[model samples]
Target: METVNVAELVERLGSDEDAVRKMAVFKLQGNIGDPSFADIFIAEGGLVRLRYLTLHASGNTLAYSLTSFSRLLDVDKGWECVDQELVERIVELIVTHPLVNILRGAMSILVSIVSHPYTGNRTSQINNFGFRALKPAIAIYPQFLEMLVSRLSSADHALCANALQLINSLMRDSITHDPEAEWPKFIQKLQDLGVIRAVYVLMQDSALQDLAHPLLEFQSLTKVLLRKWRDIPVNQEKPEHRRALKGIYLASNPEKNPDEATENGDDTRRSRRHHPEKWRRLGFETESPAGEFYEVGFLGMMDLADYVRSHGDEFQNMLLEHSTKPSRQRCPIARASLAVTSILYEHFEVEKSDMDDTKTYLISESRAGFDKLFQPLLLHWTRLHVAGLQAFFRLWKATAAEEEDLDKLIELVRILIESVVGGAARIKDVQDVEEELADFEYHRLRGLQMELLELTYEDAWGQHLRQVREELHHEALQFVKEQRIRSLLQGSWFALDSHSRSEPGPVQKSTATYQYAQLSHNRRYLHFGQFDLMGDRPPELDTLPEKISNVSVNPDHSSTATLKTAPRQPTTKITIHGYAPSTATGHGKGHSHARSGSRTTQKEVVLLTLRPSSHSIASEWLDGLLMLLNQQPITAETSKLIDLVSNYGLKIRLLNVRFDDATFAGEAPQVPARDGLDEDYYYDVFGGA
Candidate 1:
């Protein structure tokens, strides 16, 4: 490789020739990682040149220039060459950039510039190399956040996509560095800017397919926001009150920050005790019973109500429009609405003072939003059963059961049952990974159903709600069972577990502490990655088929045996090579009996022996494996370790639940399929087969 001169590249940044400027940036990116080169670049005022180029350059030239700046951000001293003004300019450029690549590059640079290096509440890391230089750049954090949130209203898909990605990157990195402790203020700033509203608006964009970035980030961000208010215990003593008051005083009066307040004199300390009640009245006593009354859910509900008061009609119209479209073409605005309403309703608690204005406001707004957003789904219930049910369940959970809300809900349930019986049900097997994630309705519905089953409502209308739930539960069970059978027929593996082999032979057993399982796509095979103790880098060990035979359940069968224990009596065992008793031979002292010379031997292999954390999880894996193996021959070509099944005795204890602990019950009752999940929905929408 030819080395380029730094001085020459810096001068070429202002070149009229686009190619020359682009080449200069490309060369500068190479030197950014070298401290000596970084020193030379800064000394020669490289940052000034890059900033100038960023504003003037177009296309690839601009992208490369931003890339060079981004790489420079890795150097501690490199940040000193830039300032908050420059950071703000980068954010502005991100929003104004017409090209997606340029916008992405600008965001990439900003993420590096503002990346927090400290984890948790520890402020000691502020002396670290990057942190010192980042002191000034840190001032632009809120500005960058605000710009990203504002861009969601953009018409350009590319711009919106990059904005979402950058925002997610910033948030995810911030949380990793200092989650709930240091990032709450930033989250509050976002909430004040109507982030939830922006999220809903962006979700309705039909052209945007990369929604996971924003959706997951927003969910995570919302949790962090709600936590600050939710975790404050209600009511506390004077000492606790004093501490909260001091903290609040410092926060509100920045000049009297803790350090300054302590430095000022003993009088500051004396004053804190004197005015504890002052801050308490201002809602500082988070742990006090009186403080506990400040439920964040109520606040969230009020915010949402206010939103509905202003945009309720727009939301209703959007819902109506999308409900009329086919599943594939339909934008998933319903989910966005559900996310907002559910969050509001989830925290909404009924107070004895029903006549209180705040209480009345919540009820009226929630009822209005619920009726508008939810009623359409019922009208279109046959085609959108799962999503409709999920939305209905969540809203119902949040309801205070005022006369109007309850009456509407009862009527909606009646309509849902009538719709289900009208024969609008449809189910499609996910053919590929993309189709599997095409919609989250099925997964959401499954979660909602589980939640409903666990909830015990004591209200007068609870019986009616339970009746509807029971019917839905029965249907869900049946649908899940059918899907599993269909998946097995197609050789789909729902999940997989990983473990280390202590001794590989006929007497196989899995023994290791750090066991983490991952979900397998298409269910064709389970690839057990090499077990690593530190969990830094894991390599693949083997890929086994999704087949099993002779599975055993908890001795109690009523409970679950975790993978952590060595069953004193051998709990939850499976036989890979069950055979005629004549051919059965003992492998070792503690090992299960294996078939010797196979005389009518079942070829299915016991690939792993897992003791899941819960009985439900164990049964889930057992049934999923058995269903996949049903009526299918275990041939050598079907699995790599087919021949070793009897000899290797693959035994792995299930250590933990993978795939977000969302398990599909083996014998679930049939329910209507969530329409948008299947590929056929898309094919029909696009006018295909």
Candidate 2:
């Protein structure tokens, strides 16, 4: 590559000849990736010239200028040169651009600027700048989001992908940087802009099937954003109000001891510390440890649930049409559509006493519309299958008042449980247990089983369906036990049967124990001993603290001396770090408790390492241990359900997929042929240089 002079390119960018200016901008675009070139270009005023062209130039010159800015924004401090005025200009260009190439270039610049890794104090400030700049365009242009949604159906694949990516980036940046205040407003804006309706139409368009991956991401992120918005503090009160309440309570109750009040306050603070983690496990985002938020409430009547209900006929028809199609097993758009619909229905709630007859009729009509979907949803082996089952239970709980309705719902539940049980039995017989444990369908069946068990345990359902509930519970437990045995035989981690024991006991036989390490049934202790082939002696067990700090997997084993002589299998070294009760007595040296006349138990940080047979088994053990540490439910069925929902329902799988370079790179601008045209024709067709 020839070393081009940055000063010359900057001069040519302001040339009177249109072709000369266009070639210079294209050359600048190709070279902006170089740090040296970028620094020199900025110093030589090349960036200022490019920004000027974006406003003054048109067609190929304008598109290439934006593309160059997109690349330059990746360099250090490149965003600083683009001020609020320039950002507003870019947003304006995006709204008014006629050609697909121009739109692609403008959107790519926005994505680069929004998704840049701004660190330290500048992160929020820069994010706020970008959002503030777009506010005017979004406010003035009512069709901004709809215009982007329309691009989802464009023939240009690159343009379609870039449009979806830009939307995803914008939403992600809003929630991630400022979830509490700005995200809720952003979501409301998107709703008001009719983006949700546009999404519904795009999802139904069969011509856009190739854009399924990004579509799923957009759908899933929308659902997540709504849930996050709901999780925000509804009561936006100041901290002073809480302090005032505390003072009032203390002043009213003079008999209350100050020490007792302090202790109670401490307990409340401790519980608040764990509140965020608990809600996060249930798929809700939490901003602070205080976790002040309401449950998913009615976000007025225009929420997603209301939208689906209002369009019940069309929504049901879409479901029926997709479910009947004979296509590939994996339908990203269809699966995502059902998942979103399921979430909407699940979040649907109404106050019966406050509801008028119109509201009641709408609810009943929506329920009936969903009732038709249960047959096809149950037949499919997708993640939506479990979601559909859960939606059915929730809807039934909300509206099923008559005994005939209850009877029909109970029979449907019975059939679903039977189907899940039969599926599990066949899987156990035909498939490898290890593979089945990792399969999504296997987890889906497990989620169905758990949902059925939960239904059986409900007080209202238990009273009406006593005999059937009993049978379902018994079958579910039997299936669980069989799975536990199979998982152990395959050398994978299996949750111990807690019903067999009242308290912590010896390690369960169903748990796979390596030669020198074992985890107790209650998962409260880890036992380690010398390697022994015979059942001769017991291993020394140490109590694990309630909170485990960390669990890590290390693949390198050559550093350990014990494994030096052992044959190297596909091994993985697992390390755990946490606090454990110290074994030292009060009489021992360095015992501060002895001097203080109090024999308080001291805790010490301990590290434990174990070598598992294979990487997959190590990962299974790691997941189980992390779950135990996080205080999440550890039953086999619950684990499977959490995995299924996190992966498919929440579309967490999108975290791994990203837009590559090709998605952002715009097609080269086409130049007109100059066979018989005069030089004036060039200046007339294109804008003046």
Candidate 3:
């Protein structure tokens, strides 16, 4: 208990008698919780003794030693005392130790260590701390993953939570840090090891109702993986790529390859340009390729509907179960279940038979499941509310051909519109309603209503729905305008200032500085100024364009632009050629002060160029500027820009593109792959060679 006795207690750790050694470890575990005691113990070489005990001790002694280390790791700079050798010993115990307490203790220590704040690449950090021990441990020792998966079923809530957290943390750190190199291997390993299945099974455990955060996190991370994995390219030699190539070859040489053509004659053929339309009809985005579809499979199957069907009862119960009071814990599981159900209903081949018996059954079950959440979601909006609405729309669309289901679908649509509009009206703040309308959920809701109007144009309910749709559409446009203004007003941009006289010189020949550029609150004047340590100075160039001509993105011309920083990303340049009033010349950090009574005006072209840190940021700026200009009649170029912005926004939101500044220092930005068939696979998929 005393600081003076800490040394004596640590010295007993090496006693010849097992009882004395165990007693010393037990005492150290209790005392190590105190920072001063931990400092004293480390000063007494207590960590070396603890490390030795972890490797050689057994039963309660090993558990006590791990507990002591866990306590020590809790203190400031305690992780600094841990070395790779000690981490290996702890990992060894994790894989081989039979005692539950020892395993729990070791897991806790590793979690504390891995989660310690660090700079630089996460992979480098893991390697430095010997956290890579688990990688090989799982690779060589088959039972390690199984052991972790088994613990997910443990009745001990802490153990269950820790096991889930440990696995999630490892996968996230490794895959996110080096997604291209690590993602496929790590995800495949998790799938092969049944880790994914274990998480699903854990969700079914009614006893561990309190483990919601970890459960929700694991499910969300899995969703991200599924989305990201679709973008990653598989080997060009894979059967999917080979088959696509052979089809193209046969289509081109139908006379010479008559046998091959006849073998595939039943297939409906389309040109490469028409592939996008075909995929869209199959319920895929135009951006997604047929090969990419084949790349996304769970548990080695292309379709997850079968798995959902197998777990149909459990999922139904998860969604349908309700508590008298709203349960925060229930919301996540319910949302996760809804997300899984959506996977089945959201995307399906339109040409396929309308509703097979299997689909009919799942729809019936999922509809009942959704019924329980509709009222609760309306009362209190959780993410489940969004998923519920989206899933219900997909369900409504699925039954489009069934005359018997038409009335029921219309009734549900009316109820949904009443609930949403009623909820919007309750929030008296006009801005709050606009904010709600801006969200993806409201967007989906509005879209569904519009679709319903098309299906029931002559129906009496159609008139009310059309009015609601128009109101929502108006609110959404207002929200977009507001967002553009807010974004323009809030942030300072890094603009490229080239000294070269030529137009848009290489970025290397230019310098970048923080520039305060924004449109006036009244939207009358465009303001520009330089930012200094103190704050923004007066405008250097304040001019509203007489004829705003062009806003576009061009590739960076800097030779030093590497994949780590730029990666073929473009920069946004706004070429505003217009006249300016004499007032545009003002006293500022970078411009001369105007003389009193100087009212001269001149016609001049002002070019503003922005070097965004990433493609998403560039797209954001371009979108804002284009919306601000609102050029007359919306040129074709401007329409294309709008479409580009929409696609980029969806991908950015899906990837949740928030990265630490340090993460971009020397690594490729781990974003989803670019749209279309991968350029790398061009030859393999369609080349004449």
Query: Which regions of candidate 1 deviate over 4 angstroms?
Result: 1-11, 14-19, 26-63, 74-77, 92-102, 118-147, 155-158, 165-189, 192-194, 201-211, 235-689
- For all predicted structures, in order, the TM-scores are 0.33, 0.39, 0.41
Which has the better TM-score: candidate 1, or candidate 3? Answer: 3
Q: Residue-wise lDDT of candidate 3 within 157-200, one digit each (tens)?
A: 87888788777767666666653465667666666776755665
Best by TM-score: 3
lDDT of each: 0.44, 0.48, 0.49
Mind giving the per-residue lDDT tens digits that candidate 2 earns over 422-494? 3442113222322332232533544565565445344433453355434444444344334433332233222
Candidate number with the higher lDDT (1 or 3):
3
Each candidate's number of clashing pairs is: 26, 0, 0
lDDT, residue 6, model 3: 74
Q: Name the top lDDT candidate.
A: 3
The candidates, ranked best first by TM-score, are 3, 2, 1
Question: How close is each model in CA RMSD to the real structure?
Answer: 28.9, 31.6, 27.5
Off by over 4 Å in 3: 1-4, 76-84, 117-126, 204-210, 226-689
TM-score, structure 2 vs. true = 0.39
Predict model 2's lDDT versus the native. Answer: 0.48
